[model samples]
Target: MRPVASVSFDDLLRAHQGMIRAFLRRLCRNDALADDLAQDAFLIAHQRLGDLRDTGAAKSWLFQIAYNVYAGHARKHARRRELFEAQNGADLDDAAQPAPAGMARDIAMAMDQLPADVRACVLMCLSYGMSHSEASKASGLPLGTVKSHIKRGTEKLRAFLHAYQQA
Candidate 1:
């Protein structure tokens, strides 16, 4: 693996940043988060550019790095979600504040009703814009399981929201 020259690395980063960010956004569904991951991926690639011998493979190399970043972020989110559940997320903050009297609070309250796995799948697939396969990969579930979770979760959310609106 030969190190990419600084000048070449600069050009590579410029040319590929948008593409990497777009790919990450498809997986993450959050533009800000996707952009952050893209920056991290580029930084890592710059640090490891010397280890890569094939400049022609730059695009693939950068994408591989981006995937690694996304996977790592998924694992971290899972851990945090577990910790939040264990500690009771409400006890941390959402509980301490008086519930805002509005749709936001209603939605949040409704979201709290969802089972953790279902919620995770919904956020990843529907809210975040991840494809079903990508959500399955991130959630470490079977493809069928991911699909099932999303289907059931959305139905529940729909019902919950409808009830809230009626109230």
Candidate 2:
């Protein structure tokens, strides 16, 4: 078999850094942690570049690596709640940083109330500007299921916002 061509890691990072950061942020809900995880994803990508057969599929391959890293981090995190608690204590003051504010906070709270599947669908579609098919693939849901979740999630968000306005 022909050896894989050497790919420029810098070029790959420049092309996909923002997408990786945003995806990690959505998955983890912590900007600093997301940045760290995104970097880790890139490191993994660089290490495994030889395994990549199709340069055109780099985006999907990178994301799959990111998803795996995020999943592993989450699993390890769950196994070490005490470590998280200690970190949480250290970061309590940082938590007081001015929140999203006003309508944005309201919307975020409403979104937080959604079922996980619905929330993922809404964020992938609205935040990331992904089409239903793309969101479905990213979220690991069926296309129809992703569409339904987005529709229902949006309706719930609107109702919550409307009720909040009236109160």
Candidate 3:
């Protein structure tokens, strides 16, 4: 990987855009929002390109930015959802919404049950094939915390899937 100062924005975007979008889609389970957030992430990356010190770590750095974007959106959405529910005297649970008809509802629900940090760590490591160190960097979590999250997250996923299989 070339240094950040040497790499073109187009090249970085071309290399990472799809993976970033896919990761966001899995996190949010919303295609449009994921696409929008992916764009937002790229924009942020472009602005911060000068800050990148090690080009070899670009992927983890990009994931970090993307994860931050998703986290910010999740926080904003949760607050708005809470206020809306309070005003309407109603409760709404995003996670309780059924998966798309043909999707694996059990897996989706299980993943949704994870806290955001845990899910992000698990997905970064398992879904994206990132190393533990990379996942740690991407999630901005300590290395041990990232490993612990992956262990706990996978356990929950396995138990959930096993129960689903039995039913």
* Cα deviation of 21, candidate 3, in Å: 1.0
lDDT of 1 by residue, 53-97 (tens): 766556656666887797788777876757887877532223223
CA-lDDT, candidates in order: 0.71, 0.74, 0.84
| Superposition error at 5 for model 3 (Å) | 5.5
Q: Candidate 1 vs candidate 2: which has greater TM-score?
A: 2
Question: Whose TM-score is higher: candidate 1's or candidate 3's?
Answer: 3
Q: Which candidate is the best by TM-score?
A: 3
Window of ten residues with lowest summed lDDT in model 1: 89-98
Stretches of model 1 off by over 4 angstroms after superposition: 1-7, 82-167
Each prediction's RMSD over C-alphas, in Å, is 8.1, 4.9, 3.1
lDDT of prediction 2? 0.74
Model 2: ten consecutive residues of lowest lDDT? 89-98
Q: Distance (Å) between predicted and true CA of 38, model 2? A: 1.1
Clashing pairs in 1: 1-53, 2-53, 3-50, 29-128
Candidate 3 lDDT at 126 equals 92
Arrange candidates by lDDT, descending.
3, 2, 1
lDDT of 2 by residue, 1-167 (tens): 33347557787899989988877766566778878899999999989887777666566667667777877787687646556568675432124234678887877668767865677678767876667876666556689998999999999988997899899
Regions more than 4 Å wrong, model 2: 1-7, 50-61, 82-98, 115-117, 164-167
From the highest TM-score down, the ranking of the candidates is: 3, 2, 1
Cα-based lDDT at residue 74, candidate 2: 73
Q: What is the Å distance of residue 88 in model 3 from its true position?
A: 6.6
